[model samples]
Target: MTNINTEVVLRKLLDNIAKEHNYNDPNVSVRAITTDGASYSSMLYAATISTPNKEELQLFAKVANVGEIARSQLLLPLFDIERFAYKELLPAYEKIQDRNKLSNKDRLVWPKFYGCNPNLYEETVVLENLKTKGYVAYDRLKSIDWAYASKAVESLAKFHALSIAYGEENPTQYAELLAKMKFNPDSLNKMAGTFDKLVDMAVAVTKEDNKERLRQYILKESGFKNIDKFYQSTGLIILSHGDYKPSNLMHKTNKDGSIDVIPVDYQTISANSPIKDLYYLIFTGSDEEFRRHHYEQLIDHYYQQLCRALRNLNLDPEKHYPKKNYEKDLKDFMPFGLVLGVLALPVITVEAENAPSLQDENGLNSILTTKTSNLYPERLNGIVNDYVRWGIL
Candidate 1:
């Protein structure tokens, strides 16, 4: 796909993987792992490396979409960030955990990385095939229920906690990583106009009672300013999974009736408030009904898990982030849910048949203006109603 020359690049990567497993003259086969509307930036492939010893390793690979228009529209740095995440950041976190002697249950869950090649057009990230491990991605259009949400938030808490611990243990390395993860705000600025257009589209379709309030709140400079602040805030900074949603996550139900979740995408990882990830997951992955029942409880659960994880890392949550401060930040950043919901709902709720074509040269602009399902207005109204009822609108 997209002329990636997989024979040259992927074959080499697979050979390296075979060597890593001490396998001699392994046979490798690859096939496309296609999912409708799954990713615009990368092509997915599943590879199998079979050793002469009768062992097999299933691998998942993400190859960059190098079409000129797609490359220009999506942030190129995001690919680098994901490479850094699997290759460097995760290994560093593991070393920190090993030093603290944390048990497997308390460790951050992620796919085992095999390798990555950061060549511009041939960018590829390969890892253990989670599907072979019985993990499946949740349907993007479905609102995540409580059982699934709990597992996801817990995993998210562990991820954030490890980031805090890693930063505390290696301050200089953490700082350098943060600097590299810093995104160009010009990208944000370019999208601001698109966001305004989307809000206007949302206002057009949203309920009559919600239209004025939603428009009045989001169409103003203050609204976009608040979103801008979310990206630039200095207080209570932690490594954030910038795109924490069900589509970017994989899950499985185990024998004990427990849900297993691990985040698979790291393209948008950045340094921001932990709540950024929390709220983004809540607002983007859940519906208003789920929120009405579990919003407060989820917030409390995340904080508790975060505290548990921090303690496991030998850091006192009270010293690093107190409950009182968390509450304040939660309130201060509440607008983010509405901001992200309106901007994301259109793309998220679009019918797969109506989803933006990756072949389009317009790239991100096509996604912003694509036709959406009837669910879009209902979801947008739900978000607006909540904000209005909370008196924030």
Candidate 2:
């Protein structure tokens, strides 16, 4: 965007923030702040809005991805989903927490929305900048440690709890939101060919005898083709952060030696089995070694946190999501971990230089062809080995 157009948008955003917070005579300064290889779909910026009295407000804005490849990948609808999340879904969640008198620590925390313009290719969503408050994105190249993973799941559980409350408290509105947020399966199916190529590449490196079984499962039985049916199967359904990996979360260490995590990037948000979110976080964010040591523990921690969060909101866990049902869902969705791990590891582990620019027709194809770090194969082998050990392959 030109400087003139950028200034106009920034002024409009600051004016909206002023209207909400009663700022007078605000002056705005903008700067690009996106991390290298941090986001694939949008440009990120940090801005400061100052008043004559010297009061300042820090803000973040996500500009829509502009390219034929990006649009073909359904970036526009994804932006719509994110805007709906900030403008509609999160506000309702906050109201539910406020009505229940939930503590701040127990509530679902997210960036404070300023405003948005959903005008076609000019799409933009603005919100309070958490980075100014010491929050930082986790390094994508590294596996998540237990401390970070635990806090992340805690935050995720609280979010799912609030989603459950929203559905129970306002069934009609919740249904409408679900209808709107249900992502296009065709958009996902577009990547099926890419994953098919990924599967062959994965199998070529497989050392285990059961590698053929892995191929059969992913290609014939458990690929993206079956995702809709799998998610629609009998399970506790809620609004899920569809891309719940480390890169999409921002964290800060507290004085008490605990990490506070907040999830961002709701562009891929959808309504589905809550287990799908858990699988995404674990498979996409952690390696086999981390899973071997803490996988079951993380699952238990998430459930425990979910129960607590639900109780804080005056909901009964046994009535809504019992342990037996959760256990059953885990067994039913077990293959999802392997499938998602194989597909996401490549994208997540690609070096910055090899990352897709999203500026050309072949941008999305870079997901299949990018040169990834050795971590990719090591992690892929780990996931396959785990499945083999568990006899799931």
Candidate 3:
């Protein structure tokens, strides 16, 4: 393993690209590199052209190598699609970019694409560095506020709207793209095993009564089995952020203290239900009361913004994404969110030291690593209690 010459290969690749881009003496430095669980492939990183005079100009590079992982893995495979999407799909969206078509006026929805090179062995994506602008990763379980949640909801609406519009207007293109996307039931099954382990841990941490209650709930209905039903029925698929949670969202504060959210980690982008994103965010971020008081409002906000965004693209939301269709989709997908919340809350809402390490082979970090600790048990319990209150569990 140590003999693996990834760095050598990466440096050579960067050197060639740097010369092509006309970067002066681009001395690439490895900043950080890591794998997102399931050990076959690795994400490699390096900083290029760092100099005092050109300090204002920074370049960050990411290379995704898919060695032996299953073809069905979610987020990891999306790196391969990024290049294709950036080249073919993104231009279409850009062509229709207008105030009415997007929820955010800033036009900062997708990551600014620099370049992408996808080879048979590995894929590399060069993107704009958001770090220089004071944007930081935000985790709801660790440190989240209303501003962050609102901004996140707004951004999600715009993203969902774009996909819906694309699907409606370019039916043939959408079908072809979805055909390329496949959900790996096996990988999801493996994830279910981890969920079972997390439930066991939560039971071990709670009182006998609560433990039994939680245990019964999970044993009766909470796993891939439940989610499979939705996949079978409507197959309500779209371009989904497979791993949607707080940690993957980057945010910055405005002068008046409002926050703007930028989503990162497009590796898991897939053709799935929009509800997947909605459910994951709600379960992982807010608690019971928040949902009880604001669930309908949040859904309304999301749908309204989505409709507005679609309208901006000159697409009729009433015809393309009807209210009835959205309602049915939400109803079918809410259970996924509820069960996922039950499975994810304990793990997400724990103290950093007490919680499982991302480095742990069987920890939360093994899947999606978030630096924030806002998802602790207290917050999680509130979310759980809300589900119970809403009669979702």
Candidate 4:
């Protein structure tokens, strides 16, 4: 067993792997290591390792603990799903590569996964560095463009297709595994107050008629009381990138002037309606005019690509993810767009440094804070107008 407290042991572990991978230069320097969040029972590091040609490769290393917070507080009690994403999820993800029947590859499109090892203290996963690839991070909600949106929609379709294909081919396994999966409503509930605040902002920015309409809809349709019911009844469960926001997607421009969307941070992977991802992406990322102009086209585009992907995976889109089912799911789950907009708009529309931190309880409550004056008037007005125009209010 290696000691967790000793930096030497950790460095040695990284160094040995560097050498084995033909990384030369004989000297390995650990540049920066830091925890990604308080909720995870893991450690993430931004490391620079010497490569064969004496070049430094920036990599991310993830180590899994005995159990993660989600597993303990959410997954175990709800779905009996285990924690330790690096140990559990990574293996399943890697198996997709091993099968070779799918088009998933690590180096070109996806983040490359290096070999994993288990020590007495913890398990470790080494990943190919992404920083050297010129990946840029931008807030999805605020940074919407044709190139970004198109790429994102296409990539998401592929991801959803993979899940549908896997589920169809392995029905028994899919059902069994998903049965243990549970949604942590606690997190949603925790953010309820923030949502309320967002609604109040929306109300203020809207015209009197629209505001009343929104108020009625908020009370009757999208309230916290009925949100869970919507999720439960929606028969559109697929492996959703739970956190399908712009920040989680990385982008790099190719020589041809096209942008590629690379999905990272799979920790929030869950069985949810694909529309949930769509709702989150569009509501948070796109502006009112863009959404108003392209909403129908975008929705149709997403479904079309999703169906194409499902077909590519040899899965019948009609049987599992038909248009009828998608429409029904949208009717029930699309309210999340409004609901999350109320809660997310303040933060999503604000300057990064000025936005409330998720780490603070006060900031958390501010998410539900009913004060509209603190938000950007233009954005809030736009959101209210769009909801009204869509008849969602």
Find the candidate with the highest TM-score and give its number.
Answer: 1
- What total of clashing residue pairs does each candidate reach? 0, 0, 17, 8
lDDT of 1 by residue, 305-356 (tens): 9999899999999999999999988987887887887778888778877877
Better structure of 3 and 4 per lDDT: 4
- Per-residue CA lDDT of model 3 for 3-99, tens digit only, reads 2355665566666656666667756775664423211244546455543455433545666544333333332465666676667666776655653
Native-to-model Cα distance after best TM-score fit, residue 63 in candidate 3, in Å: 4.0
Model 3: residues >4 Å from true position, as ranges? 1-10, 27-30, 33-46, 50-56, 64-78, 98-108, 117-123, 182-195, 206-208, 230-236, 342-376
Superposed model 4: Cα runs more than 4 Å off: 1-26, 30-45, 51-56, 61-108, 115-126, 139-141, 184-198, 201-209, 355-376
Which candidate achieves the best lDDT against the true structure?
1
Better of 1 and 4 by TM-score: 1
Instruction: Provide the overall lDDT of each model, using Cα atoms, as 2-decimal numbers.
Output: 0.83, 0.82, 0.62, 0.63
The TM-scores, one per candidate, come to 0.94, 0.92, 0.79, 0.76
The worst-scoring run of ten residues by lDDT in candidate 1 lies at: 219-228
Q: What order do you get sorting by TM-score, best first?
A: 1, 2, 3, 4
- Choose 2 or 4, whichever is better by lDDT: 2
> Whole-model lDDT for model 2 versus the true structure?
0.82
Candidate 2 Cα deviation (angstroms), residue 167 = 0.9
For model 3, give the 10-residue run with minimal summed lDDT: 33-42
